[model samples]
Target: MNLSFFDQFASPSLMGIPLIIIAMMFPALLLIHQDNRWITNRLSTIQSWLLHMITKQLMIPLNKKGHKWSLILMSLMMLLLTINLLGLLPYTFTPTTQLSMNMALALPLWMATLLTGLRNQPSISLGHLLPEGTPTPLIPALILIETTSLLIRPLALGVRLTANLTAGHLLIQLISTATIALLPIMPTVSILTSLILLLLTMLEIAVAMIQAYVFVLLLSLYLQENI
Candidate 1:
């Protein structure tokens, strides 16, 4: 019974083919392509407006060179947001809940920014390891500490997304189970629990959106530093 709660996190497969890939691709399919028409439908208009707002907010802190990444960042944000919200649906799997998937997304982008810094301005990038006027005794220790912190950024990114979604899912499941179990013995308490569950579901929806935005926002901040 205890292990059943964790089973939800496992990647679903059929005939030895993982369906997580399909889940990841599903969001992109929902995006509508714009035509040459002068006017568009309400759905398309709303999509365009949201994308515009997100892109504008993300690009505010970035320099002109960083703006080149607007498309990639916006697409990533939408993908994550869709996956998170989709996971809340009944019987749907969330790819972002897996640490491996999150790390795969994080490491490449993090490495890209790091590599960009190294390629464009090697001196400035290396200078980030140490500050000016540091005592000789603390140099080695500070470099070690900074290097460790630098290496942990991608790991932190992956863990943060995975942990938040996983915890929310677990809490929802637990509360739902309690509500069901109490319905037979304590009708009043069960209804109250159900109401609480409803509120938690709404909060989870907000968390789903916020976490996606945060993941992208941090990447943009990292890019800002390197660029």
Candidate 2:
């Protein structure tokens, strides 16, 4: 069921920009509150333990740059997670399904990857961006294809997230709406659909976390590759 697109301005007062604004503040507040020697010492101890456990996969030392990257990614994940959970309420909406919101999250990472690659390895970054050992005859074709595919990554990521959230929300709405419509004739089917939606809602919560993790992990991998 394809519902009309929800406008950014045409939202409930409490569920509109205010909700997203507050959601975005969660990470900032956390970081701000932890800005101290005690929190720093505790975080250092935890990071050391984490590094010891993942010694084998350690591609680079967690320097200032790495720490900042991790902080930014974690903040994004937290913000998205909060917004998603908020949408599960009685009359709230998920801003993540909005193209503008998703792209706002995706484009910066894409730009960061491009800038990092160029900044770190200015001399050979372009050459390395294309695969090695391409036949001279097919070089142009390969470059064209690879460039297009590279550009599509962020687009695909944005669309994938938006589509999933929209689909799940629509499913819940349809089930509930149908249940109300057929309450007298087919209460059992409506009840079953509602149960399925409830289960789906639970699964979607997990999915929201998974999506955030995957996005951050991929961004890390992209950064690692450049360095």
Candidate 3:
């Protein structure tokens, strides 16, 4: 029984083949594709509007150079948003909950931004390692600290998404289990727990959306600095 809770996170397999790839691709397959129509349906219109809003918000802090990333970042945000929300469904696995997957998504993008900075403006980029006004004695220490912080960015990005989704899933599972266990013996408490579970599910939905935005937003910010 103890192991069963964690089993939900394990990748499901068919025969001997793992289905994780399918799960990862499932969300993208749900998106509506345009068929050369100038006028779109209501669903497609809403999707387009939301995409426009998100793109506008993300690009506001960035310069023209950074605007080149609009398509990539928007697609990433949509992918993450869809996957995160899909994970909340019954019997579905969330790839974002895996540290490896999140890191894979984070590291490449983070490295790209860092590389862009280093290649385009090496002096300015390296200058960020040590503040201009620092005293001579503290220069070495401050550089080390800042360097460490810089290296930790991708790690933090991965762990943040993993931890938040994992905790919320675990909490939902625990509360759901308690509600089920109490249904027969304590009807009143069971109902109360169910109500709380409902509220938590709603909150988790919001978290799913916000975390996706935050992940992309931070990437845009990093790009902003580099550009």
Q: Could you say which candidate leads in TM-score?
A: 3
Best by lDDT: 1
Comparing 1 and 3 on TM-score, the stronger one:
3
Clash totals for all candidate models: 0, 0, 0
Tens digit per residue, CA lDDT, model 1, 1-227: 77998889999999999999999999888889899999999999999999999999999999999999999999899999999999999999999999999999999999999999899988998889998999999999999999999999999999999999999999999999999999999999999999999999999999999999999999999898788
- List ranges where model 2 is wrong by over 4 Å: 1-23, 26-65
Candidate 3 global lDDT? 0.94
Q: How would you order the candidates by TM-score, starting with the best?
A: 3, 1, 2
The TM-score, computed over Cα atoms with residue i paired to residue i, of candidate 2 is 0.75
lDDT of 3 by residue, 1-227 (tens): 87888887787889999887898898988998878988889999999899999999999999899999999999999999999999999889998898989999999999999999999989999999988889999998999999999999999999999999998999899999999999999999999999999999999999999999999999999898898
Tell me how candidate 1 scores on lDDT. 0.95
Q: Each model's TM-score, in the order given? A: 0.97, 0.75, 0.98
User: Tens digits of per-residue lDDT for model 2 on 45-102?
Assistant: 7745654443323334444455557656655665776676666666666777777788
What lDDT does each candidate get? Answer: 0.95, 0.67, 0.94
